[model samples]
Target: MGNNILITGAAGYIGGSVLANFISRTSGPIKAAQISAAVRSEEQAQKLSKLGVNVIQVDLVDETAVKEAVLRNEIDIVVHTASAIDGRIPSHLIKALGQRRKVSGEETYFIHSSITTLFSEEGGWPYGQVRDTDTVFEKEKEIGGPHPVRQTNILVTEQAKAHGVTSFNIVVPHVYGRGSGEWRKLSVSIPAYVRTSMAHKIVYKFDKDGHPPAAHISDLIELYALLVEKILQKERIPSGEEGYYFAMAHRTPWWAAMDRIAQSLHARGLVAESKPSIWPSDKMAADYLGFPVLYVRAMGTSSGDLVPVNAYRLGWKPKWDEEQFLASIDDEVQAVLELDTVKATIFDLLTSADK
Candidate 1:
């Protein structure tokens, strides 16, 4: 227990997976207490405690508390996975939905979680959105301008590194999987579309004309485990920067997949008739109107072509691709609907074994 590692956001998606990975790998007694989880809720603390992970309620933004936690725990490795979900649900939107629900809500236009897209401009033509990519995800993609998640990693990683804790930063792209993900980050749009199709008896809806990109839950966990293994094994890997990484998976045209989904839903008798349309009122057309938007995400999702594991040079590798990744989401979504217990199941799995 000499080389203690502190994992932040242990109750959340990526954090939960990271914990699961650590526990799954190291079977026998080893060097360093090796693992501790930090969270805010007492409930989360108790859950993690059950897993045998020392759980602490500390706010990392409070440099002093973070410093104290690291030192008191004798933590040598810190994996920070804390951040606010970017809620695009405006107050008005929520109110409208609530009112609609109260007033015999005839299931109207489906809702979609808003996303921070990236884009790039090249060959004098601009791509509409940007995302996790080789250089800044998109050439000039719409930047969420360095998210708090990335920032927190910096603080924790720097602190650990400064104290001579061999460190690596694992930046996870939108992650979707079982016992993981919120707001469709790792969700493969196809599965969601299929679900929608089944409910409406339609096969697909074309929010946009392109296939979306994604990262699977297991793949994301595997990447983190790889990073931790690489670090504990004392291997040198990139800390982003010169070797920046973005988690990506198989990309497919959105509408086509939606069509397939609708067809499946019809076969299942979940939906009635299908209407092929885009999710958003208008798809990428409006986004392309803005120069900044065009430069960021438009092309990243549509035309982005690169290996996500290149970020592995920075010490991260996900042994997953598009086809398997999409299938996993379908499984997760179906399980959640059928069992109606995604959150609880996630907690049990994460806390059952200490990492």
Candidate 2:
């Protein structure tokens, strides 16, 4: 029998890319009919439906609704990518999975999405490259966050395991590149910088230099597919917090990234100067751009070197490095300039053509 797959947050950037990649490329025991998308919008639903996907409208907060949806669909593998801040969704889904396992005598799996920001400290900066083996935790309450995604991951993973649900947690770094989905196209940080620069007509610089880690959306999705394939084959996956995988491709210095974007905008006559101007203060930067931009600015203030040793050991390779990522900036910026939509990216168009 084919494995039935259900992805929550089907309308989101990562989720959408995962859905498209999985449905378009998956083979050997996973069929397109076995794939279902739990989306929140009709527009997303219609678009996914056109792609021959099974779309189901889901309310992440509604425990009963989520449970009913899982059992009703007989989801063998549940990938949770939406709202990591909410702790109930994983528990509810695990409960439903337990019930299904009892009736059908089959095992279930849950892939929970997490962010690398959990590794950030208020003033801590690592001078050397850091790997997944370097990570250690104290307590969830001691951890600060814009959102407590890491803490929630720990809680949910524990609950899922306690309920006999095979859980895998994936921690992704600042994701770049275009995503092929119905709703959004461009990933965070870079596009935010581009849009902010377009709005202000110039690109600003930072005082210090820092290179944080990054991952291409396609590479991240590929890792997800590999892990899912292993799970379906009844292969052993590194479980628990220590065994969790960090999804990252390479590291790019903030100033270098700024230069690439500024060059693209300046060459296109979109910005006044390619040379960046130093921001006076965080508050002023936030005022000029937006709160989200501050997070990008923070990249320059600290070192976020995340090395994925586990990915290599598992034989998962990333196709795009910093150079390739930088080389594609012009295309991404040009897509936004020509299309007049933040969702438009050359990568998305290219990937969609492959389908």
Candidate with the greatest lDDT versus the true structure:
2
The sequence of per-residue lDDT tens digits that candidate 2 reaches over residues 1-355 is 2378888877777888898888887556444338889887677788778878878887766888887888888888888877565677777877777777776678888888876665554223333445666543334334434344555776766777687777777877778877876667666667767887888898876788766667889999888888777877777867654556778778766787788889999998989998778877765565554433434355445555566777667778999898987788887687566433534231232233333
Q: What TM-score should be assigned to candidate 1? A: 0.61
Q: What TM-score, computed on C-alpha atoms, does each candidate reach?
A: 0.61, 0.85
Residue pairs with colliding backbones in model 2 are: none
Worst 10 residues of 2 by lDDT: 344-353
Count backbone clashes in candidate 2: 0
Give candidate 2 regions above 4 Å deviation: 122-130, 133-147, 287-300, 338-355
Error of 2 at 65 (Å): 1.3
Location of the lowest summed lDDT over 10 successive residues in candidate 1: 107-116
RMSD per candidate (Å) reads 14.0, 6.3
